[model samples]
Target: MRMPQGKPGRRAAVPPWLRARHPDPVQDDPRICPDQTRGQLGLFPTPPRQFARTHAARISDRTVPGFEAVREELRKMADERQIRARTIWLWRLEGIARLALAARDPDREQVAPQALKDLLYSGPILGQALHRAGLLAPTASHRLVPPRGTGPTRQGGQRDLDLRGQCAHCLAWANDRRVLCAACTSWGYHIRKHGGGEAECNRCRRTLMVSDGMCRMCRIIVAETEVDTARIAMDYGDQLWFARPHAAGLAVGPRTSGTAAARGRFAHKRRLARARAADELQPSEHVLNPAQLELFPAPTRDWSRLNTATPPALTTAAADLVADFFAYMRGRGWNINFFRGSIRTLRILTGHLGADAPIRECDIRALVSTGIHVQGARLINYLRLRGLLEAQPPRDLSVARARRSASTISSPAFAAAVHTFIDVLLGQGSTPSRPRSSKTIENYVATVLDTIETWIAQGLGDPREVTKKHIEDALKPLHGDQARRLHTALRSLFRALKRERLVFRDPARSISLPSNRPVPAGLPSDRVAGLLDRIDDPRERLMVAFVAIYALLPGQLVQLQRTDFDRSKGRLRLRRAGRMDHIVYLDEFTLRLAAAWELHRHHRWPDSSNPHLFVNRNTAVDETGPPISTAAVTLLFQRVGLPAGRLRIDRIVDEAHHSADPLRLIELFGLSTASATGYVLSAHPDRKPGPIAP
Candidate 1:
């Protein structure tokens, strides 16, 4: 559990500070700083004490025994008119003394002194005035005069008296559950349980008295909504409960228009104020307790404990720096693109800005360039929306850089890592949106880790070799599967390693993979024809039949466009269609069916300007070319009675069957690596590792 750091309170200034610093000299241990946490509180006072003697002429009513007689008289008066309960109590207390004194001795007993009682009931000054007139012996005559000092309450040598808050209902806890108690839950007349003398309800008002745990008229009043539920509370009253005023946005009244409403609100405030004053109380800030935590069912996957790696480079400071950069750009009127995907990339690039950085440009390409063709397109779309890409994107650039394309996190490794975490947190597994023939995300993880381990082994021994060439030399010995995996991991590292600026240059620069096939074989030819012929759905039949005839790669088979076959032109124009070179033309039968199906799907002429011919009906976007999803089409063919087969009996996409094509089967499916557009023959496959040429 993380322990929260407490915020420091505000420092008091001037009057408050000075008063807090100094204390009354009269008291013992009168050091100003009372709290240990605050250490020594500095108090300043220039003037020295000028003590003056105080005196009062009148003494307390307790000196005389006429209290009983006074109470009777007041009760008689109360019978006829009005007197407060407190007043009645005072009279009774005085009367008891007076009556008892009379019983002691008639001759020596002085008459019950009204003057002395006056001093006790009223303050010292009133009693003193009467005493000076020679009516009473008031030994304790002087009230502490002129109040010792002058300043704020805390500053002045007077107590910060308990605030007399208005009477309001406050919540209290009972047992383990919430409940209302005597305050709001129960009502009763409260007669003083420990009675000095009996108290009658304020003379002439409904009589109510509190004794023990009971009250008379209190019960009736409690049911009454109008009962004084209002309560007075000190600013920091221990048991006080307060709620914010009902008015919201009222504080933000129009500059001039709502004067009336503001006045009304202020008037209500004034009423509450007046009520407080009547009770000798004031308004104060309300403090509340933190709520207890409630329990929830445990998560499906336990993340509570694991030696989870703390993200090394993705520091909060770096994240903040990136945010500030965006904000700064926004402030400067820069046209900025907003995207969550770029969050990781920007975080990696500048998060550790000026710190030991790991990011460089080449990692950019591996991050952004690889993956489904549409991945880059999606990012481009996002950047364009944010105003990052000002101009339209150009046609496909044959060659891609590993360093320049990373916009998400540096590379596939981060993507894999993030995906791994996401899956673990969700209690599932991660897979790439566009998975390769045999590459699992776990494989990427293993490969990346391997690549990192190799680097660490080679370079950790000597830090100087951590340069780009050193990485290149380390990679030079690698080839085939290891080389690809090594390069892939290196790619991911370089992509995210931008901020570290570890590499002298893009390490994977000038390195390219070879065109190869894991061709399917060992199936009789009849099974292939039978699979295609058994398909009844015209679309599935044509798709499968065409794949069989052309022996195209999965990408080419999926990338087939409506424009590939032109009914008017009577030919299929295949662009770098696959690992094959040469323009492919479909047979009349296949071309006609593809064209007819497209024509049949059109409920009405499609909106002008869409170029895709084999468009997915489900995807509503106006695609550049009408398209069909390869996976969906493959599945559809299987649903339509196609059987398991290899080269001849090949299942198009399912793992159960491996589909393959010969390396030089180009003419059968016209495809050019550079531009599949209206192809011509090439002696070899395009340098860009796409379709191989016949």
Candidate 2:
């Protein structure tokens, strides 16, 4: 192919093949110069040369002699480079021009020539440029001299002081020289300022300025809140002494406050004045007005003080017996009230027997001869129980029967049958395949034994002689459910007897009872509110809320532990027998109440090892301090004149009516399908039944 030759001043020819690929190559290609060819491809292009010349001319026009020298040097370097000479020269020129423009005075039109030259060749500036372009060796120290005409360097120590002036702890900004910001300073200041130097109100523990030792708010609260000061003083005279009115006003004082200390000093003075009156007191003067004595009992003389001085005229054996009686009462968990009553009884016995009498001479018969025989009988019983007296007290048949009521059976065969049946139900006897709850077995056995005993008391002595007529007579007075329960127990008993070949016929086999009953509608809302309000204790209120709002059964509530409540999720999970576990979502109010009750429970029973959600405060009777029994809960509701069971039924009925979904009710309350269906029907009796889908 033929090549096209260049025009007069144009440098070279382009090969025809190159021209053919791009016809009129200069006009077609933006990057290719008309005078440039592949032979000069590595050399500087004309466009970059023209750009450098224009920039150098502008720098020269500014009369920056240092910049002009830099531009000339850049040109020399460009000529030395074989490749990208013009581009390299342009970049170095641009870098020197930028430094000159930056170093120029803001008020002046031109930069200092010497300063511009110094900055252009400075190690820091050149090293920075190389570092920015990623051409400097990373391992090599890139530290360079500071450029001339730069402002003063920041003081390291001043910067550290500024940083420290800001909160050293929280690192928040501070206006003044402080280690901590205003907020942090205030927090610590308040803590130390109010720690404990000032006197605090006894009721609320708020700081008090008045030496009376109560803040204004607590004083107002005490004024508004009614308290029987007279009754409190009468009952606890030593602990609750009233102060005289001061010039300011009448202020109710707590025994734990400063007023109490003042009152104690005044009381000491009064006691000194009363010493003469006490010395003049005759035997007859000791007799108190019966009416006044009922409100504030006459103080008993401290016999221990007299005994310590004169060893009490009573024999050593008698003193030992008295001491042992008190020890036994204490070991049995008797309260101080019992000790007080026992002390009074002992005083009467000692006065009657004459304090000098021997313990062996003080027989129960002789004590009974004094006409106050009940005290004598109690003392004799205690002596016998403690093995101090050998002769056992006569056993009253009525008391014996009452004590043995739970175990008593009319016939030995019936008793044996009942035991065997319980063992079978508990998976311990001959027919032990069908295991049952021990509690359920106990209930069934009690009912069966009671029914059998009643029949025997009515003249049917033998199980074989008892007929269906006797069973009907015994169950006649009971309600429908009660009758059904009795019948079921009797039927199971007779079946077990027949299995054991002890009886041939089942008296309760023919007795049929209704299988379903309408669910009871709960107490009215106003009544429920009143009952809940009547329960002031947080623990009791929370328990009632569980039954009334969550529809928890007594057994479920009693079994609930702290682990059952999911605080994060605000849900209570319960495991029930014969149904899927239930999860109840708690509302904010209920959750708050639960939390408050939990805190109160911990405070009241701090030493308790019980994990129950609700626990009784009394740990003497129950060593483990378990949850309050269902009977105790029932009694609580009874005291408030509300039925706990009815409240639970009300909650269930309310939920059933509101949702009308049997499956939802079953899931929510752990109710059986049949029970849920019954509750739904009872809630909305007028609703038509839907067709069953098969």
Candidate 3:
């Protein structure tokens, strides 16, 4: 090759004639033209592409404002030995310049450093550099006039100076002019200079210093150290922290005095107080804080102040009632911590109704209309208990909820018929030998409400308009218990309505449910032997035996009383509503279980006044003598891994298998004739039904 160019590494220059003929070469086609052979072979060739070279812009000619100022400041910093000549130093200066340009002020010559706060990749380092270059203006006056020096104020020590001083590192206006900024003083300094460095901690022996004597790990343990309060009290020979001396259970220590000893003793006492205050109320006894005992024996000063300091607008009678209600709650051992909401609600009610008038359900209803129904319910209950209520005691909560379902009916006539049926069922206007329970009324209304709404939707608004066709159509989609309940509810509703003359006809009278009851089946042979072994709770074990052995229903089991047990006779009297009471003979196993449960209840809840045979921790404390709920009895079965109803049915069926007599099953388990017959058939499928018991 000939000489390349003037320089060894440079390209050779082209002649003027050659350059004129070829100017600049245009970009070539990326793909090669396909030949016949290539096409047949499915080959497509691509040629290399020519990419234009890009030149990087020079930093000196960057569009950022104040870039020259940044460079000069960096040079000054280097001269002053503030920063070294490193690539990072140049990058930092450029970053400062870019941030300063973006945060530049249009109204003034300099931008406030606060303007640079939120920009991308911006920080105090960039702002500090720009501030040192005189690009940022100080808007905040130095203490409004003369700048404060880096020293303590008269009131506070270093905190005052730190607040007044502007930090050079942060570029804040709070730094003092005479000395370095308090915060920035440590920015470039070693921790050793400030009495902090890696040294072995005294407690943990770790090479990380937190304080003069401890590392961070050891310091946390020291802060959270637990002390023996009883030892401190015994050492001091002062007032007892515990109610009983034995309760403290701490050894005496030598007594000490001095400021440090006083502080340690005070801390121990505070910890003890907090621990005692946090102890929860025991199930058998009330373990209230010592300070809260005053609330039980008598009202505290604050309570007395509230009682006597009634507003002038409130009547004397209303104020007395409010005081009595609070006293009643206090007597019931209610914690006073929950009294704030009730106090506010009662105050609002008594203040508005005026002391001149007695608070009545009508007045409470007016408040309820204004959206305070929860408070109204409380007020109504209080009035009823005080015998101040004139209206009948509020109906069962279930009945109210069931009535709400009837309110959704589109037709007023059908809705009224349903409500009247519910009222009659609850013994509101019509009296029957045995009034239906709230739950029974609720169930009846729930089953028929959907059918009533369906009839309304099908253009039969009146119950009189409901014919056999309507009842049949509604019953088409329902089956099993749902179908049976619907049929029973319809027949009862129309029959009651016809008696009341609300409906002229009874269409559901002839609609019959399946007379055949489902046969009761026993549990598997493998599970029966070990079912009672799994229940460890004395109460649960007793309950399981009642359900699994005696075949007692959950409802009857929950209603059992201590008097009903008849321990002398070894018999349990199950007094269920709507059915004659039945006496169950307890075998030796069940009697022993019952005795153990009674002993457990007596020991666990000795102070309890509840008379129920199976008193739980919750019901034991209640003075109303309400027995443990059916849900509690069901939970006992669940804990044993078998359903209560299934266990009871299994017991009845097993009994039937042994006897195969319907009459014995009925008298033994208090089951109806149909139920007894079903169990008998389930036990022995070839057995015929016995005569129905009258």
Candidate 4:
């Protein structure tokens, strides 16, 4: 044997004379070259070439009996650890097999079953490998044992079992017995000679004592302590117990049963019912804190006092007209605020016209007598629209007609040109196609008319003589949105006119609007809290919170149905514009507030059949009011001096400041990448402001 020169375990380099001449000793033929096996195998007769080939073929074909089983066990373990690659699993298997082979004799050609078993159960590296491979049991309580004589020998005539057999009592491996295992002899099945008892606990099947049909541990749980019983009785009141005020005793006995026990049970149930009723009546702390409570005091006026019934002083005809108007507004989806305003207006209108005056006899003059000119005009228009009053020509009709007939180069002529352009857009002219809808055409024409009127007022009336300077002058005074609209409309009109050869030039083409300016910084945190504190209505407070914290749009907030809120998961599922559902996790405060609001809403509108989470309070016309409109939600925020758009911008900016990642904004707030990037840039103090294209 050769030894290494320096290292303790390193092998020495073999001398050239002693080195094997052939790379593979198995393939070396001693008959062909007598020097190949000069020392050892040369003394024996050389095996035939055919025998060598057959032996090698047999060796290649051999396989372990339970190789597939071992592989499957390893696959399960790999899957448990989220290792999906097949090559990695194969490598692990190869390592485990090599370790198993090297565990005992290194020179052995085959691994012994006894040696493999010992390696598996030795609780070492090999044991862990076997456990991971699912060949060895995970816990001793569920260990398997080999059949009777097939197991390994142990001390005291005992035997160690394989992983296939288990003890009957504890489901663990038994040394020799077929039923009870050696380790489970004491606590599990008791031998007949060792005082085996017949009585056993129904729960754990352990031996029972004289008290009840349970073991000590189970008895301790089923039988309440005196302290526990007394606590329950004292805290909740004397309705839960059946025992007659016994001296603070704590003992296990037969369950009490009698008329008194039955009565006690009934009283306990009644008390629970009363407590639930009281809970419903009390304001929920979860919904509002002390500060919020101080901000929004409870309503003292009786809801029944509202004049939902017919006004006693009004005539039948007048009352009928008022009812019809209310119904009309309700069908149009007008909010509670509108309903209230209309009600107040109606009171003033009815008061102006005496109770005896017929509704048909009333006119705009009657509304004007109330000393509110705007309200009078609105009332007259509404009554006329609803056919409750005689229709009359609008006050501006003569002016509009005169402008259309005028031919001179004046403001009226410009107005007439605008009307003609509007007609062209509405597909009432020589144009071949009407690409814009009536609503869009009206909006475009209105914008163009505004610019034309501005120019005519500046003493420039000839449409042919309109220049880019005039267009720029018209656009300069306007804000970004107004300028953009006017520019687009004028461009469209000029393009149409040029195609028709009506204009020699299209001056609007050179007109451009500046990019939208970033929103102003939001109110300070203390100011925002102060604003929230001023909102007394719970529903309004929740609506503002959604905008102020989550940056939910008005449309999104109004469209929220009861099903969107998941109380158990503390998540709100919002369906965005593209019908994609976005889930937002609620914080502790929001969760509690939501829970309280849900309870309050349920109680306030118990009979309401609307599925919307937020509903209108106009119960007179709509018994079960509809979902709150986006306009109403906007007004709610406006009432507290917070613009919804600015609130959303502030929230996005704050989020950007914290994360400084535009992608996070896009993911959380559903903003476009460009929009998110703009907000992020605006948040940075070092970044210069640049114009983004409108």
Ranking by TM-score: 3, 2, 4, 1
Q: In model 1, which range of ten residues has the least summed lDDT?
A: 50-59
- Which residue pairs in candidate 2 collide? none
Q: Model 2, 111-185: lDDT tens per residue?
A: 332333344344344334433433333441321121222222256623332243334333333324344445545
Residue pairs that clash (backbone atoms under 3 angstroms), model 3: 165-174, 165-175, 166-174, 166-175, 315-355
**What lDDT is reached at residue 561 by model 3?**
85
lDDT of 4 by residue, 1-694 (tens): 6676677887777667666663434432334212221112111111222122223222332343344555565566666677668675555454455334323232233333444443333224334455555554334453334443544456996664332244443333343445555655554244334654547655445443313444433333333322232223232222122222331432334332221223454556556655564444422122212232345533322323333222224445556766876776665555546446456556544533432322332344543344432234334545655555544443433334433333333475465666566556656667675545454665666566656666777778667878888877777787777777878888888877765566788887766666766543655786566666787777887888788788899988877888998889988988865457888777887776677777777666555556777776542123333556667987887788878988888898889888878899988887777888887777775664558834
How well does model 4 score by local distance difference test?
A: 0.55
Off by over 4 Å in 3: 1-392, 429-433, 576-580, 603-605, 616-618, 635-639, 661-667, 672-674, 686-694
TM-score of 1: 0.28
| Per-prediction tally of clashes | 82, 0, 5, 4
Show where candidate 2 strays beyond 4 Å: 1-407, 433-446, 454-461, 476-479, 619-625, 690-694
**Pairs with backbone N, CA or C atoms under 3 Å apart (clashes), candidate 4:** 145-165, 146-161, 146-162, 296-536
Show where candidate 4 strays beyond 4 Å.
1-450, 457-465, 477-506, 519-523, 559-585, 595-613, 619-631, 684-694
Q: Estimate, for each residue in 1-694, the C-alpha lDDT of model 3 and write its tens digit.
A: 3666567766567888888998663322212111122112111111122111111112223354566786677666666766655566666556445545533434345655455544335445556667887877786633311232434455545345333433322223444552444433443254567767667555434444345465443332333333333332343242222233332542322433321223655577656755664353122121122233243432211222232222224346556767887886676565546654455556555554433333455645544454421245445655655665534354568889888988988898888888888877766746463468788888898888777766666777677777898889888888887888888888888888987788778888877766665666788988778877787888888888888888778887778888899877999888866678888998999999988998987776665677778877557755446677778777767766788888888888889989989999988888889778888888898666468934
Q: What is the C-alpha RMSD of each candidate to the true structure, in Å?
A: 27.4, 37.4, 31.5, 36.8
lDDT of 1 by residue, 1-694 (tens): 2333573554434476667788533321212211132222122211222111111111122233443444454455455555457575544444333323322222222322332342244423323322333333334332211122432245655643221121222222211112223433233322233342234332112223433222333222222212222442222122212342322211211112122223544456546656565465222122111242427632223222422222223344444545665674454343455334444444433322221232223333344443322123323333333433323334322111111122133345433443443233223433223222222334544445544455555534322244566566766787777777777655654533332343355555555567463433334446455665565655565666665655555456566565565666666666662333346666777776776666655543343234554445333222233345556755664675443233422322221122123222323433233222212112222432445745
Error of 2 at 355 (Å): 34
Highest TM-score against the true fold, candidate = 3
Give the alpha-carbon lDDT of every model: 0.38, 0.55, 0.61, 0.55
